[model samples]
Target: MAKVKINQPFTLLDTRVGVAERQTVQLEVAKLYTHTPMTIPIEVVNGAESGPVLMVCAAIHGDELNGVEVVRQLLSKVDAATLRGTLIAVPIVNIFGFIHKSRYLPDRRDLNRCFPGSEQGSLGARMAHMFFDLVVKKSNHSIDLHTGAIHRSNLPQIRGDLSCEMTKEMAMAFGTPVAIDARLRNGSLRSEASGLDIPVITYEAGEALRFDALAIAAGLQGVENVMRHLKMLRGRRRKQVHDAVIAAATSWVRADVDGIVRAQVTLGERVSKGQILAYIDSPLGQSEEAIIAPRSGIVIGQQMLPLVNEGDAVFHIAYFAHANSIVEQQLETFIDDIGPIS
Candidate 1:
């Protein structure tokens, strides 16, 4: 087990504070190979009374930069002195990956797939174990931020097991328009946290290594919505009620031919069966194959690269025919709230 020592006069719970004092919690979680300390940086803004502990994390996948920026902006504006309980922000957990601009550990392990990790395992596993123990296990709620994989772009969306009441409540509280009732994959953070009964949600948006302004805005608003739901911050009742539909299923539409792809639809566009989505054309445009949607639904994700292989995934659409009305209304509000992309 990892050793821990809490500073005295600093109670872990029911911490009381006034408007003049903002409490900050700092600690060293471990030491890196470079002999430098790996600081598990935490800022606690305890309110005068009791409330919930919400953790906002970023960069589990080091290539995802929008979440990192969102956390940075969140810290800048929050007046901790007037806040409640705690808001633990881990801006960069995968430090090694962040520095290398890679998605996995030096040992080639994907941290996201190594959750509830072993303390006596690889570097990634140890870090995962440490993070889950020190950060996730102690919080009332958690948000794991991410972006689309390296060559893909995602519409800002919250993915979680909506079956759990707490998870569903928080997902709705997260104001993102495209809330996907994503199933929990084994070894994923959501799965482990669910096992431990910790309510956690994952927000994915934009594309890896790039920052989209709409993604940032949607993220910020989503966090605020969660805080509002938890009573951590007081705000106006959201004008639009969250209307996330549970997608019965989802699938990626793959390319049928190899060529330069010209996409016609965007991230949030709705398409009917057989609607043209993209056209794979030869280098000289002499031969072209039109890729069409196989089913009717909204495009939650898509490939950003124009180049395509014979079976490359080009689009990910979620099927929710019954809930299209609510989904459409919520999407409009989300688009309006995020405003035009910067």
Candidate 2:
């Protein structure tokens, strides 16, 4: 086994937290026009024993708050004194978007797409560089928490490049019933992390700027499960997890007409080809339309709001070859396994 120096101070961003110590380190991202500096808050828990370093981070989009809560709850359950490795929990990654309750930086740029950025780049790029340089480079593995964009809710699932053995292990260990074998977007954080050979998995659930207890519970449990798998913490599995699918194909069902929609199915429901997924009713006329599933798959994502424009995406479905009645029951039980919020 590879060994990391133990019983010593863990220095990050020039701040030192000793082994068996849990400390919060604040990283400065930028300075406001008022000469005030923006900062990203980080919690570092270096274990007494030597093991792989894992970073669980959330809220890269700023509006994705479910992950924020997940990281908070995860920190509460971990004790640094007994931890075998190191954990760096960053609940808020996009400080600009988070403070403004937006998914974009002040410049309206997607912070997620700017990675390993330059110091003299755009605000988004600079911020991404700061986090990657300070947090990501030091970690052996990571989990990037996320939620569906505004007006959409996602069934709890894991998304990443499952072709990588390490990534595949993390996704399976997450206990989510569905997993998307997502491609790495250009300049994305996951892409940048993968470039450095660090494996990362993204957990998507709930909606932006909102808190769903089920998503948070699933996220927390999933993180704990991953830690246990990595031997960073000793714990019992939260539930009997089943195998997850590397979705063979996935696509979004777009609106056929501009109108208000009434979704016919809920997230996580299985659908057959040509099945109606939602109904759109125009406010001014009788131009009602039925949105049908283009292929047989599970409804992994859907718009929460009724308002829509023609061609707008309404449903995200993923096709799995082995999905059947048995898989459907597993999804139902998985939701219940996460437990209640209060």
Candidate 3:
């Protein structure tokens, strides 16, 4: 494939960032009820040479903060003079939710589901419209950073519609131990980007509201890997520590009884079908129920909080074609390679 030359200055949010220059732009999206202005902070790094424009954004859910740190660390290491293309980094997309330390907007609507939004729609829609039009559409490719919901933790993984060749390539380039061939959710940024023919892959890691060192380190490395894959960063291709295994399907194991959960499995642990993952016991210790895995797979996600209600999801397992034991070894090696990230 021939590389497209992009020597011209990159324009975003009405600001022109010249080659070899880095600029931080404050994008006004909405106003707070107290009359204070709310803006999404964005940094554009226009490279010295020509390559694909890649957008790495995080905190679309506000509380999913691992990605914010990933973007921060990634920007710290990127030098525009040595870069081959543009890097548009948006650290926080939902200012309102971030301020409140919640996952939804002030209107209680999910910002992620409001993509390709209308200018005259609700607050989420309007903010989504501003972000989608001004930021997302300006890129040739995208990496959406995310984490599990509140009180849940996800193993480092890449999720995308792997049917698309470009999306699959980006997922593999991300180098997660496991990559889920996920379906695009309607109204999501990925879905809307696909409409415009933009290849976007989402990186899911850690838990919401808190930062995990390993997750953050892996995320930072994954973004750099993708950038190198796109030739936006100059480097001889670094091989993935472990070749990412594509999951055939994933399902959540729900608790059959409401109680405090005593989890027996950890993230990345391979479990056999019908194996006990967690035991839900009553407060008085009079009753207990074991939560069993419905299928043999790797535990990709699980609820962090011990308490759960009936039918609450406790574990997320991903099925693969490879032997579960081999996947477990790959996961162990990947974690050891990352080590402690203090």
Candidate 4:
């Protein structure tokens, strides 16, 4: 560990007890179109003891406000003086999207997809580069928070590569009812981080631009569980939460015809093969088309929009050969553990 100089008060490091100061590092990443400046807020709690440095970031999409609030609530309750390891919490990364309540920047580029960004690249690429350089490159582990894009809704779930031992351990520590052993997408932050030998698990829940209480509660609890797993804090004996079942694959059930859609199965509900999951109806209420489940599985995600286009994704079902009774029990337990946000 590099010894921080005593006169360098800007960087707080206590050598005696090894507890460093929690400082907010503000960096002006970019300028907004409205002639206002945009800054990235990075709160760093570099603990006195030598331990893992975990980074928790949210709102890369700018519209995903649930994780922003999750990080906010987590910071409010956590005291830096008692922490063992370091915690870097960047509550909001996309200031542009956050201010406008949109998923992408004004340039229409998805920030999450721009990874290992180039300094002299597009706007999104530059932002990604600065983020990765300052935060992701500095952390030992990380968790990127996300939500369903716009009208889409997701049952609170943790997505990661189960093949990686550390990634799997972190996902299990997340304690979500469902864990999608999701594959990495090209140009994605996780994919780039993996290339750098840093495994990051993304927690997707609720919907963009809207704050779901259940989702927020689940996210908050998941972060605490991860911190506990890392032994960053001391105190009460925590229960060993079970690992999430790795789904072989997942697919979305699409609407047969464009119309108003009515869903029959709720999120986290188990369904049998050929189960009527929803119904698509014409605007005039003249004709109706039933949306049935193609295979028996749990409804992990769905769209919130009542209106849909033909072949629009309606439900996300993860198929598993396990009995519904066991699946339902795990779902119930996961929900119960979330408690209440307020």
lDDT of each: 0.79, 0.89, 0.92, 0.82
lDDT of 3 by residue, 112-187 (tens): 9999999999999999999999899999899999999999999999999899999999998888899998888988
Residue 159, model 2, lDDT: 94
* Candidate 4 clash pair list: 18-48, 19-48
Residue-level error in angstroms, candidate 4, position 5? 18
What is the alpha-carbon lDDT of model 3 when measured against the actual structure?
0.92
Off-target runs (Cα >4 Å) in candidate 4 are 1-18, 236-240
Rank by lDDT (best first)? 3, 2, 4, 1
Whichever of 1 and 4 has more lDDT, that candidate is 4
Give the TM-score of each candidate: 0.89, 0.96, 0.97, 0.92
User: Where's the lowest-lDDT run of ten residues in candidate 3?
Assistant: 234-243
Top-lDDT candidate index: 3
CA lDDT, candidate 1, residue 213: 89
Leading candidate by TM-score = 3
Candidate 4 C-alpha lDDT tens digits along 243-324: 5766667899998799999889988899989999988999888999999988888888899889999889999998775676
Q: Output the lDDT of residue 333, model 4.
A: 80
Summarize candidate 2's per-residue lDDT along 1-342 as a digit string, tens digits. Answer: 866556566888888889899889899999999989888999999899888889999999999999999999988989988898889999999988998999999999998889988799999888888889988999999999999999999999999998899999999999998888999998888999999999999999999999998999899989999998898987668678776766888899999788999889988888999998988997875778999888888888999999999899999988887855555787888877876658
Clashes of each: 0, 0, 0, 2
Tens digit per residue, CA lDDT, model 1, 1-342: 934222122233344334324555444545668888865455555454356778898888878899988888888877654555567777887877787888877788898988989879877778888888866887879898999989999988889998889998998888787677888988788899999888889999999999888899888878878888887776654555565666677889999999999999998877888999999999998999999888888899999999999999999997885755566677787788666676
